[model samples]
Target: MAADTTEWKIKKLIQDLKDQYSKTVRNNPDTVAQIESAVRILSFLVAGRFENGEILSELIYSASNLLVFLNDSVFKAASKYVSKVVNVTKEKIKRWLTVLEYTEVFLEMAAKKKWGTKGAWIVITIIQIMKTALRFYVLVKLDGGIGSTPAIQPVDREILKTAEDEHDNLEDAWDEEAAYSAQEKTFTLQSSGRQIRTLQAAEPGMRTWGVPESGTQSPQNSVLNRKRKMLNQPASKLTKQRKWAEGLHIARPMAHLISMYISGLDSWKPFLLACGMDVTSMYLMGDTKDLNAKEKAELKRRNMMLLYYLMRSPFYDKYTKMRFIAIFRFIAQYVPLSGFIIRPLLEYLPTWQRMYFYVWTL
Candidate 1:
C-alpha cells in the first residue's frame, strides 16, 4: 500500500490536472496537453498501487464504457438494450457513494460529446476523474477494512490476461524484475507460485474425540475441552443494546440538524450557485455545440435547482445525519478523556447534579 500522504498527493495532483484539462479543453480544442496529463493519470490508475485498486479500476472502466455508449447517438438510438444497459450500469455504479459517483457523473458528460469533435479531450478528462476517484476509493477501503484479515482465494489465470489487455507495456514489465519488485510485495503467495504445498496431518480415525486413547484423554478431546472453556465467558447484551439505542437517538437529532442547516434559506442559495460551476465543469464537453449565453444561463438555473434539492434531499438528510453521528460516536468512544467527562452525564443522574458538574468543568 502507498503511504496515506502519498495517496493524498496523487489525488491532489489528479484533481489539479483535471481542473486544468477541463479549462484547456474548453478554451483550445487544438491543445494536446490535456491528453498527456490524462494518459499519465490513467497509467498510474491502471498500475493498481492500492488495495481497492482492482475494484476501482473495474468500476471506472465500466462507467467510461457506458458513458461512451450513452454519448454515441447511433448506439443509444439503435437498441432497447442500450437504454436498459445504461440504467443497470447506473444502479451498479450507485453502490459506491463517494468518489466513484463523482467520477461517473464526470464521465457522463464526456460520453455525451460528439464522436469526431474533441472526443479525445473528453476521454482524457474521464481518465483524470478515474485516477482521482480511485485514489480516494482506495483510501476509504483501506481505512474501513484496516483490521480485517481477508481470506485467501484460488489464483485465477485471467488476472494476468486482464493486465496484459489493459496496458501495452505490462507484458515487458512482467519480465523485468525491477519493474515487478514493488508488485511482488502486494502479491500473495497463493496468487504467485505455480506449485502449492502444505504439511500433512494424522488421519481423523487415529484422533479419538470423546474417549481416551490410552490412559489420558485424546488430543482431539483436549482441544474440545479448551474450546469449551473459551466459550464459557460473560456476554454483555444489555450494554450492547444501550449503546445501539443511544446511537439511534443521536442519529435522529443529527439528521434533523443537518437537514435544517442545508435547507435553510440563508446559505443554501449561495451554495447552490457555487455548485453550478462544478456541474458546468463536469458537463462542459457534453453537448456538441458550444453553450451560448442563453444555453449557459438555462443550464445554470436548472443545475442550481438540481444541486439545491439534491443537498436538501431526504436521502442526504438522513445520510448526512448518520455520518455526523457516526463520527461523533467514534470520537466519544475512542477519545480517552471525553468518556470520563461524558459517562457521569450519560448515567441516570439528577439534572441538578449534571448541571453542577457542567458548571464545575466550565
Candidate 2:
C-alpha cells in the first residue's frame, strides 16, 4: 500500500472506536438505559436558550431530539436484533418517549408566537395535557422515570476548555533546524527532508483487568436505591389529592391561555392563580423525606421559576413595565440622543412580555 494518510488513519480509528462502543452499549443493558435517560433530559433542556438567536434554538432542539430518537429507539432496536440481549419493555417505553419529543421544537416555536388569534395557545395546551398523560403511563408504569434516571454532571471541563495551553518544550517542539541538530548525528539510509519527523509509539500505561474494581458498586447502589424508592412509593404518599394538585400545577399554562381567550378573569388573576397552584402543589408534594431526590429537585426548580412570573403580564404591565418606561423617559430627558434606541425597545416590551419573554424562559 502507498503511505498511510493522517485523515484516513483518523477515520479508521474513529470507526473502530464507534464499533467497539456500540458493542459495549449493546452488551450492557444498564448503559443503554443510562444513555436513553441522558438523551431525554438533554433534549428537554436544549430549547431553554432562546435569546436573539431563535433559529439556533430550533436547530439545537431538533438535534437533541434526533439524539434522543437514536438512543431511545434506533440503537436499542439494532442491539436487540444483533445481540438478542435487550430490555424490550424499556425500549418500547423509550420509543414512545422519543415520539413525544418530536413536537419539542414545534411546541417551543408556537409558545413564542406573538399572535394570540393564530391558535398556537390552544394547540400547545392540548398537546401538553395529552403528552403528560402518556408520559405518566410510559415513564412510571413501564419504565424508571426521571427519578431512577441518572444525570451526567460536567466536572472540570469548562475550566479545562478555557485554560491556556501549558508546555515544557524540549527538542520536540523546536523549529526544524534546531530539532534536526538536537537529534542523533548517526547517518541513516532514508532520504532527508526539509522538515523533521516525529516518531509515533503506543501510549505507556498498564491497564490491569479481570480483578473487579472498587467504587464500581457504589453507582449501582444509587441506581438500586432509586428503583427501591420507586417500588416502595406508597399510594398514600402520592394520593389523589396530591395528584389533583399537581394536575392543577401542570395545567397552569392551559388555564392561563383559556382565561385570556374567554375575557373573564382579570389580567392579573391568571398569573396569580397559576402561582397559587404552583404553591399548592409544592405544599402537597411534601417534605424532603416524603419526596424522592428527583421530586425534591423538581420542587426546588418550581420554587426558582416563581421568579419568572415577575416578567409575566399584569405583573409586567402594572409593575415592571411602568418602572422600565419611567426609567427610559428619565434617561431620555438627560440624554436626548438615547430615545432613538430606547423608543423601539419600549414599544416592543409589551409584545415581548406577553409572547416571548415568559415562554422563552420556559
Q: What is the TM-score of each candidate against the true structure?
A: 0.15, 0.46
How many steric overlaps does candidate 1 have?
A: 0
Query: How far in Å is the alpha carbon of 167 misplaced in model 2?
Result: 30
Per-residue CA lDDT of candidate 1, range 129-244, in tens? Answer: 44334333432332211000011111111221222233346434433433333333232356654332212222244532221112334344455445433322221222333333
Q: Count the backbone clashes (under 3 Å) in each candidate.
A: 0, 0
Best by lDDT: 2
Candidate 1's displacement at residue 217, Å, is 39
Per-residue lDDT value at 153 in model 1 = 12
Candidate 1: what lDDT?
A: 0.36
What value of lDDT does candidate 2 attain over all alpha carbons? 0.49
